[model samples]
Target: MKKPLNAPVLIVGGGIAGLALGIALRRAGRDVELVELNSAWNVYGVGIILQANALRALRQIGLADACIAAGFPYAVSLHHEENGQPQAARHKPSLLDEGLPASCGILRPALHNLLRDAALAAGVQVRLGITVADIRDESDAAQVSFTDGSQGRYSVVVGADGIRSHVRTLRFPEAMPPRFTGQGCWRFTLPRSAEVSSAVMYHGRQARLAGLVPVSPDQMYLLLLSEEPGNPRMPDAELPDLLRDRLQHFGGQIPAAMAHMPGPEGIVYRPLETQLVAAPWHRGRVVLAGDAAHATTPHMAQGASMALEDAVVLADSLDDADSLESALQSYSLRRFDRCRRVVEASVQIGQWQMRPEPGADPLALVREVAVELMRPA
Candidate 1:
């Protein structure tokens, strides 16, 4: 008889992917234990944009409505010239069953709190300030040694940890390291303007790109993308001033938003890096999920969406398959191609922004990918 997937599962990270997977597995009648390295579990970033595909995945696990209620929902995206003259607008089609919006912009903290609460409510055992020190995949189970000196045996081990995944290093030592995409992203939260109703993107002549996304009724976040020749460590004290200097060339509501920019503490900046682990996301009973398996740039805004889909699909596969190996195989087979498209497409868009060619159209590629992603994950 094939081994049953009834034993407890271990998740090594408690970020968006880890939390979502915990909820899905618990709902599927599996005992889940999640470990987060951070003790306080503080969420970083100003906000996040949840495209329709992401909402669909969240809907599968029963969190879509709450996310929509807590976030600013809209379906329109406006493109503008450097001087703020409107160039074009496109409406995204809804992917959810009910009459939900096509996309949502939400505060990172708010979304994190919702997932954390749902995972706990679903009876997931969560351990903070702890992580896996070592893992061994045996015939019957995966032996895990926690950083806290405790040990456990789980039916399967999932590495949902981010790009710098310890589990990945321990398991797949041959995988390529994360590659820098030669660009950095800057984000800051500001009070929303009444005129800002939809997602707006500014094609700047002086700067590469900038965007404004509404996170709530009275709050919005600014995202600026620029080419950083060599990845430089920007100091926090100079972040606010540096961000303002970058935006000075653009005209529009940006000046007004800049007026409300707070101290360096309120700004968030990070160099964009991407990684996609090779197919067969699992070896033995140990598997990889979310950013650990595929980390994409924010150009497509599908990083979190892909992670959420991974959770739902993985749980469904485990419940439907007869053996652990086949279940994990099905999960990777179903996800690899779609995720590869998103990752590669996002990187291409970032490259276009860095070096513009005569015929390159990032917006067109975005639309094509969006339509493809609307399909079932």
Candidate 2:
């Protein structure tokens, strides 16, 4: 009789993609171990907006309801002019008429805690402050050496690591590195007001984009995207003043929100980076998923959702395939087109935001992509 499939799968990185895959694999009756570079499972950023597709993926892993309960869900998006006057508003098209809201926003730490706890509860072996030092992919298994100097042979090694994935560096040495998208995003948390009922996007002249998203009953966060070439790193002390200056050009509720900025602690800033690793996301017993395979810009707010979808699809593929190679190939085939579309569309949106096309309606592009993403991954 043929030998059974490899056992004890090893997942590198404990981020959303890694943890979600760990949960799904363990549920499929496979031995799953996950390692993270950070000792403490911490997350940065003020808040995250979970689009409907993301909620659908989380719902598959049985964590959506808990998240929705802990977050603020709203179905509408308001577009405003540079002066803060409302230009237009649209409600997300409901994919399912059921009670599920179109989208939700939550504090980043809360989402991380939920996933980490759920992964641990699902019987995943999580090792913190550790990572893969070396990986040797053989015919049937991958021999992985941890940074801690310990070693284990796993049936499959998944690189769910983030955009700067060490696993990707090791596996795809020839792949292009992530590139700056000529824009950077600034985020800060502020108290919510009664007037801020929906997610609002403020578009100023010269390709300036800002958003106010509600994360809870009493809290919201501001996101500003501006042209920042080369992804320069700014000191923490200067962040508060720099962010305030960036918002000075806008009016409406933004000025009020800017007044609430406590200091540097309330601000988070990062340049947008993106990359789409070419096909064949696997080699031998090693495979890649999530940002490791395709890291997209945040214009669509589908980064986490794409990662979650990757986890679910990968686990399901392994369960149905006759062998490991078949499963990895199947996962790549199912994922490539969908991910490419999102990455391309998001990058296009960012490009358009940086330089508006004459007489072009960029909002329509945003809406088109949103409708496309509403379909199942």
Candidate 3:
């Protein structure tokens, strides 16, 4: 009789996707270990807009209650016109009658810490201070060699290491390189007085997008997005002046937010990019998940949620397939369609927003395409 394969399945990232996967796979009675690249051991962002589909997927993985406790739920999401006027276009509760609420806003670090605590409580081993040295494709199992000269061979390996993933680069080199979406996103968190209650987004000239995400009753995440400028180096003292100049035309809450900004020390500039993989997401005992598989633009706020969904599908497929490769194949078949749809949709939204001038009026666009968007494809 052959010894049953019992090594822990390895997850290469400890972000939302990998942590959720660790928790879910643990709930499913599978052993897993999450290896994170960052030595700091904390999520970096200030906040994110959580989607309903993501909430439901978390429920499927037994994380619903925990997630709810960690974020603030809102029944509506609003979009505004370029002149700082609120538009009639809104995502209301009805749109999510079959899904989660319209959205939840969360402090990324708080949420990550909560999920990490849950994963640890559920008995997922997390190994820090390690890097992948090499990967060997044996007939029976894929072996992952670490820099410390430690090797782990398992029945399955999940590549959730994020965009620029080592496993993806090693195993599927021909896959699409990450493409920059030609936008620069600057985000910051400010401690706000408890007077603000609503989340808001502004569309301005050249289609710049600025938003305030209230992650808690006490703090808000402010984001200003513009076209990525070449040789984009600005001094710390110059940031505030630059922001004020760029946002002066937006008026309303936008200019006020800029006026009240916490300054350069609080801001982080991120250039957006996406990766497309046009292959089987797995080979033998290895499979990709999260940004390792598909990293999308943040326009729709489905990036984190899509990764959460990946975990549930992967666990379901693994439990159902007879062989490891077959399990990976089943997982790809189950998740590829939905994940790809989200990635493609996110990119489309980014493309539409990153125009050289002010975007078409949402009212006009809605009148023109809302019916088509609502129609069955």
Candidate 3 segments exceeding 4 Å error: 1-5, 92-99, 192-196, 229-241, 356-377
Pairs with backbone N, CA or C atoms under 3 Å apart (clashes), candidate 2: none
Q: Estimate each model's TM-score.
A: 0.98, 0.97, 0.88
Q: Using lDDT as the measure, what is the rank order of every candidate, best first?
A: 1, 2, 3
Model 2, residue 296: distance off in Å is 1.1
Compare candidates 1 and 2 on lDDT and give the better one: 1
lDDT of the candidates, in the order given: 0.90, 0.87, 0.72
Clashing pairs in 3: none
**Where does the lowest 10-residue lDDT sum fall in candidate 2?**
1-10
Summarize candidate 1's per-residue lDDT along 134-191 as a digit string, tens digits. Answer: 9987877888999999999999999998999999999999999999999899998888
Reference-based TM-score, model 2: 0.97
* Model 1: residues with Cα > 4 Å off, grouped in runs: 1-6, 96-98
Candidate whose lDDT is highest = 1
